[model samples]
Target: MNTVLETIKNRRSIRSYLPEQISGDELETVLEAALWAPSGHNTQPWHFLVIQDKKKIDDMSSKTISLMKKSPVDWIQKLASREGYHLFHNAPTVIVISGRKSADPLLFPLADCSAAIQNLLLAAESLNIGTCWIGLSKFLFDVPEEVKTLSLPEGYHPVYSVALGYKKEQLRPTAPARKEGTVGWYRA
Candidate 1:
């Protein structure tokens, strides 16, 4: 198998990370990979906001946890703790992905952003960096103004985010198992 294919297959969802920041060149490589993701009709509707400022990152996570703990759901409120989830799992950097506000097609924005993030994570893996996609923060969108605060367009909304850093522990990934009858072909 090709090196790229191996990297893709071996990559796992990293949950724990070291405190070191990714290097500038490695960061550029990951960003470049994201730019190459397939988009609908070449619309490329996705945009990324990279956050590395310590104070800002800390503030954002603290505020997010504060709000989430107020949720009526007991499970969610319990999980919104400063112990492990503070500063977005304590990763050194975060890339907030958003999409343009338009009516071309609703699914295009999400699909494009998803593929872009896959490329980013794969590229990060190749560079020995780890990335974890964090979707919980989207709850902040419950408030209208968070869109602008995240540097999104007036109407654009956040789609997802990826936390990036070096892995603190070895990620043990199980082999891919076969789906008994998942594959299908039809021609008539």
Candidate 2:
């Protein structure tokens, strides 16, 4: 099998991480991968906000959990109130990805952002780093004040975020059987 394909198959979403921070070089490599991700018309409408401050990361996690608690969805509320739950899973760093407002409106913004995110995730996985997409932080993007705290430039919108760090323990999740009936063929 191809090395890239093998890496993709082995990659898993890491939820637990060690307290040690990732080296600048490793983070840069991941960012470089993201920068090279395919974009519509080469708009490359993505900006990465890397937050390495432990205090700030913790604060964001706490705030996200607090907000989750108020969600009307039972699952979200319960999960938010559960003990030993951190939205970022105590990762040493968080990278917030934003889509540039100047991107062509006709082009796909979220899809472009997703491609960059996938590149970052795969790059981290290949480098022995762990990463998990913290979708729980999505709510924060809609809040103007919270967005300001990220210091994103004008005309940029937060799309998603990922927590990155060294794994605290080996993450070898049992392979679940893939669901069937999800594929289709259009060849005629």
Candidate 3:
């Protein structure tokens, strides 16, 4: 396999992390990779909010769990009620990716943001940094007050968050088995 393929195969969503923070250079490299991701109409409408404060990260996790406990989904409620369940898995840093609103109906900020997130994840993995794509943060984003705290620029809304830090375990987890019949090819 080639370099990109190898990196893609090795990358995993890491949940466990060491308390130590990642280096500034590593974080910057990851963010730069995100910025290079292809965007719709080259709008490049993504914004990154990097939060390194443990207090703020913990508070966001607590608030998100509180909201999750009120969810109608039984699994979500159960997960939220579980003891010692931190939303970001206690990573030392969290990056919130937001997308700018576009008037064009065909423009999809979420799709563009997702591509950026992929690049960020891959870059972090290449650097041997642990990362988890945090969809659960959406619970916090849904709240207007919580959104305001992020201080995002006008017309941009939170899309997703990523938890980043040094891996707690030196050993990487084995990849899960791939499902078959998911791929299709059209040939002329």
lDDT of 1 at 107: 53
What's the lDDT for all of these models? 0.81, 0.89, 0.95
Off by over 4 Å in 3: none
User: Mind giving the per-residue lDDT tens digits that candidate 2 earns over 1-188?
Assistant: 99899879878888899999999999999999999999988989899999999999888889888888889999999999999998899999999999987545688877899999999999998998999987778877878899998888888899899999998878566556789999999996
Kindly list the per-residue Cα lDDT of model 1 for residues 18-137, writing each as its tens digit.
888888888899999999999888888888889988777777777778888998888778889646777377889999888876776545788889999999999998887888888777
Where does candidate 1 clash, by residue pair?
A: none
> What's the residue-level lDDT of 143 in candidate 2?
80
Worst 10 residues of 2 by lDDT: 168-177
lDDT by residue (1-188, candidate 3, tens digit) is 88888889899989899999899999999999999999999999999999999999999999999999999999999999998999999999999999998889999999999999999999999999999999989999999999999999999999899999999987889889999999999999
Model 3, residue 147: what's the lDDT? 98
Ranking under TM-score, best-scoring first?
3, 2, 1
What pairs collide in candidate 2?
A: none
Candidate 1: residue 132 Cα off by (Å): 0.2
Clash numbers, per candidate: 0, 0, 0
Better of 1 and 2 by TM-score: 2
TM-score of each model, in listed order: 0.85, 0.95, 0.97
